[model samples]
Target chain A: MDAIAEKKPVAFNRWLPYWAVFQADVRQTLRSWVYLFWVLLSVLATVGYLLYRFGSYHEGGIVQTASVHVSQLLRWIVLGSAAIVCVLTAGSITSERGTMADSVLSRGISRYQYFLGKWHARLATVLGTFLTLGIATLISALFLLHEDLSLDGSLVALAVVAALLTTVITFGVTVSAVANSTVLGIAVLWSMLCAAGFLMSFLPPRYPSPDRTLERLPYILQGNYDLAGLAQFAGWSLLASGVAALFGLGYFSRRDV
Target chain B: MAENSSSNMVVETFKLTKIYQNRQIALNDVTLRLEPGCVLGLLGSNGAGKTTLLRLIIGLHRPTAGWAKVFGKFMTPNAAELRRRIGYIPTNPQFPRGMTPITYLDYMARLFGLPKDVRKPRLASLIRAVDLLRVSGDSIAGFSNGMTARLAVAASLINEPDLLIWDEPTHGLDPEARRSMLELIKTLSREKTLIVSSHNLSDIDEVCNHAAVLSHGQLIYCGSLQDLKGRMRRNHFELDLEGEQKAITKSTTAIRALPEFKVVTLKHRRLELYLQEEVGGAAALANVLMTLNDNKVTLVSIRSVGQQTEQAFLDLVEKEESRGFARIYQAEAA
Candidate 1:
């Protein structure tokens, strides 16, 4: 303290890869009981639904009589697991502010890198879950329905689900970055989602056919796809998520940890 | 600005100020320079801006006015390269509850961009250094506070940083754990420049050679610990005498009459004499002994009791309070 000397910045290679944070977050998310429980519940519900559909088959063969819509099944599963995704990602940044931020941020990583890394990681988790559900739905359709599901159709449906999840996860991350506590982050995100869902339900139908907008909204329940509708879905999803992620980065870069 | 070229200076600040969103001024016009390889004890009461200053240096908060430079680089939001050279252990270090210490450290190493060849050996050595070898595989959720703190130390050292900052490192630990933590800090200080912020004066006294005292977001004093104590040392001496009441009373009266003695009080068989500032304690004691001898008093023992560092710190804070700065002295009392 007594002796003051000239200061010089220490030179070092600064490499802050988003992949590092992404990998760590993925491992932590997978190990969490909440995530594991969600996976188990989703599997059981899918299997049980398939069993019920199989049991309902009449004199006709399972291939022609049984009705097991893969898109509708995935929609229900995604809705069921929404809480888990929200709970896991809603506190990702806010919770770490006091706990691990001090150690991690004090190192050679920018706030943008940290936020992006986490966003990518959580998005990856949701996408991975959707992929697994897709495979299971396909298998159940092939065995129980005795119908060959088109790989291209399944991919399109999966893409729609992935796009929707990206928006949800990005919204959660934004709230987490801005909120002061984990509870607050979770509360804000869930409330916003609920309010949005409630408001969207009130809007009058603009198209002649109800199925037209349903295909474009990125809902997993709708299996029919028009190229225009899918393109609109992907564009809106990316735009919303990109905007939310940018907002999160903006707030996080300036806020004190 | 020209002096910023020297590599020996680890941290430098110029009029650094931080005002929270609520309008609370956490730090104000604080300008400090810290050299490398010195263990600096940051002494302050709670909310006295110790943590605020540390956060600014570590780039956790953007300064409201002025600026701080670490390793000669201004600490901005993008100063990631500058931060890589520093290791920081926060006041409360936390991790994902389910991860083990070894996994956590490995994660930290990867975040630091340590190559695989380097990370494995470094991770193993840090685990051994922090003495977490046996339970390194156990989850952090089950770790005691002390174990968590030890793990934090290991994680911060994963990159072998040149500057290490610990905020209340020994806080919330039992006596034994506190001692071990201090010993670890002491050992680390030998190799790396260290900054330790704590309310415990004795902890600082045990480990820090240099000290900076903060009061109400203002730095009141900053210098070597010995110099600070020396500056605050009082000119006083105590003597234990075995004598009759009459002799003691006579000696007190005689000692009081001496020109060198500023204040004299006698209680029981002990005597305390305050000498003039210019009068050295040794010379004043010599005069007191002569006065006692003349009264036929027997001197049992004599010694110089200068003010301890704790007292010096409190006195400095009190002086600052007198200058109209608010003081949070209850932390010191605790």
Candidate 2:
């Protein structure tokens, strides 16, 4: 039998090689017209939301509380910006199956590295987009709406949004890895997101009461030294994202590309 | 497995087989061993499992039974080091739409862990080698089929892989491009082990020293090109006559009566003769001419006819088809 003993010792961090793929993917995402279109749409939506908020303030001739304005901005960022994230990530793997994987994978990059690279690259883009929108919204709220936003509440909300974006992007990556085509991956993700939204619409009021331990995980982990609803939301979001990422990696590694 | 463990061997497969989810037996009981520094031409018709075997060797598809080893290592999903020694170009290789040849190769180089200093000059030399220096900076999306093929070739060589697998490298090229590609392949074969799978017989004849022919997922022939040709060579000759039909008929009968001629057929003024295995070419020709001359027959022309590689390939495939084997087989039985 062959020696099989000359196997190169794996490096300390095996995933380090994935950085190259990540960088290439990031460049691809930036150059894509789809990303440009989504970025523009997000910006325009943010601007529209700001205009509507300013109009409400002007018409009522009263300054709304900072929490109300922050809540509205968070809703738009999560709903509107997350939609763009889904679209951007939905084709991350499927589009590359025929076009690039044959060449790239044959060069000795493992499926796990490729999947992880794409995952991290797309997550960076989505998170950057969310941060930019969040900052812009905060600046606009403080300057135009003239409300004193609480720093603690704003940070917690940002953390919650970050967790939510992570979950959506990971789920989108899973869909991308499983589907055979970009269109199919996008359609599947869109349908699932719609289904989740439909289901969430029926939740009862006060579903997570103040006394519930499940409602207090995110704040507990955020160094806020408190247990609250945002903490629980963050915990659940991380768990879902972790499970989706694992599933994507497992399926991608076993299936022929 | 023990017999195939030589360091010189670049690839080895033992009873490798692949069955699709739809019950299509893509490859069955394929046992092959390839040494370094040879161009292996993989020949077969459509659905003959040429691509399937190549994919299995490259670890793109898992074998349903048995396995393959590359660079003395069993192929696996995480065979990164093993795969680093190989470069593969798929049929009709496609790249991301916006990348130029330069950028694309650069990315590939990085994936192979080539440092920046080495990558720059290597990319430049490969671009010049493929004669793509002129358009190396242009987006590959706008390249023609020949240009894409050239880029694929260049990309495959970016890492200086020990083995290169090209699936129909010249399938869609124009005549000039095809010629250039063949020349490129010939040049690369000097230093690297190559597995070129193609349908064009002339291309194989031009560049390959050895060949493996597949039929219905079975390896019908695998050996040196010269050996394959030798196995299919025939002791045959064609004769043209310029005499009366009576004289021609008499000469044909005389030739058939000779023990040297195993089979003879006459059509109009032309005669085809197959010499007995024991008869040498020179002696057989002399005997036929002497017989014709004695029969008052005027011989217009005579030429020996040997089977070409294409003829041999067709004959092998036709023979396999006539056997009428089922398309699917049990994994263990295969």
Candidate 3:
């Protein structure tokens, strides 16, 4: 009891639990075979593209070369990693047998912290894999393409892709937090994503659809994309993510662990 | 109402109830208060709501009706500050995959916001204390049930919590592990308030002063362990008598002829005396021994079974069930 009284003054950081969950979850996800397989695929695809590009000499304009190269890297991340993220995050809460109960029941953590901590951990890891591929492609593209790429364009394009991945993961974790079974979570998440993708495709470019984002990436990287559309899409993407996050937090906080 | 009611108690439940989604009453109308320095042993048969009651107190499961207060504050999912003063271990405790004992305990310490100066040393000491130093670096995935249970114990203690709540702390443990765990609980009982839930009555009898029994999601008994044991209607007595076969047989035959001593059995050189409720325990036991001595039989040993706690618990549950308490929750009736 005296020890506890002494500890009372040690400055308990409110965010420490969230950070702990984030760090541990990132470590776990990075070491998992499934996430590792996705990492390997993204790596191999980027390397294979670089080999093909550098193997032959072509004066294709820097814009075109960079666009195609960006597409190649983003191909694995935006298109392929969606399902991988679903598999990885859809069970973030539901798959836990008793670990969630154990951690939350212990000293100093709210279920909200645990849920958000895991949510961001998935965000960081999936984005981490994306960054690995993005940087590798950009570094290689600078030397092989032998043209001054638009730095602003590349950053913007990368940010958009990052935003897209974040949305995918947010919804995936939302499904995880809501569903009681990992398998069921995966099914619901994929269906939600597919339905959202379909709806976005039919709507105008301002709707922030995955297809629209990917389709406009070349122009975005060339600095010729529509700014109004980008702003609208960014706002809408952010709003969608916020809504998903709120729903997850609400349900997870109120429901039984 | 809950806040003002249990200010002086370590744990207070006010008509606490929990009904699962399927309309199953996992806990019903359980109201009890525990003073500080009290070690409460939760007892029940299978599906007896022991886990449910503990979970409700720990704020793991929201009650369907009523509420619980720990340390004078209401229990809720977001009550981090309140929970910080409590250490909890769920039944069949599970640790996250891809972590070793060292890493997991460290994570638990960090969850409590322990500074590095405290967290690092504390985690190191806990791992060694739990006898996990040998496997400190190995992945927890390979640990046995006993090893995992030990790690769970370490995790629960990382915060130096004032109140410890454990659900089935000795469950699934091998004999040696179970003995060691009960010893740990007994030692901690001297310093902190604890609520331990288990079906093992002797474990409770050994470590707890206060006891609560549940049957079919309803509290059947709550008070001192001695009081609960005292509820038994009759008592058992056993003896080892050494003498000539005819002498022992003649002594046992005379004892068996008593009207009050309904259960008397003799085999080999041992005699068992079961005193009915109407029989005076001390007088009946004395008469039997005197008869043996008068017959020139040597009293090698004499003892009474310590299983009265088990029998007393069974009696409570049976009494509750006999009132048709379970029939109220039957699915067909619902």
Candidate with best DockQ? 3
DockQ for candidate 3: 0.59
lDDT tens digits by residue: candidate 1, A52-77: 76665434435432223565566666
lDDT against the true structure, per candidate, is 0.79, 0.80, 0.82
Q: Tell me what fraction of the real C-alpha contacts between chains A and B each candidate also makes.
A: 0.67, 0.54, 0.66
Better of 1 and 2 by DockQ: 1
lDDT of 1 at B115: 67
Candidate 3 lDDT at A125 equals 88
* Interface RMSD, one decimal, each candidate: 2.7, 3.3, 1.7
Candidate 1 vs 3: which has more TM-score: 3
Ordered list by lDDT, greatest first: 3, 2, 1
After superposing candidate 3 on the true structure, give the runs of residues whose Cα lies further than 4 Å from its correct spot. A1-9, A53-64, A97-100, A146-149, A204-208, B1-5, B144-146, B239-248, B276-302, B325-334
- Candidate 2's C-alpha runs over 4 A off are A1-17, A59-62, A81-83, A194-228, B1-8, B233-236, B240-287, B295-307, B325-334
Q: What are the per-residue Cα lDDT tens digits for candidate 2 across A88-124?
A: 8999998888646788877767888888999999999
Write down the TM-score of every candidate: 0.86, 0.85, 0.89
Q: How close is chain A of candidate 2 to the true chain A, as a TM-score? A: 0.81
Scored by lDDT, model 2 comes in at 0.80
Order of candidate numbers by TM-score, starting with the best: 3, 1, 2
Candidate 1 global lDDT = 0.79
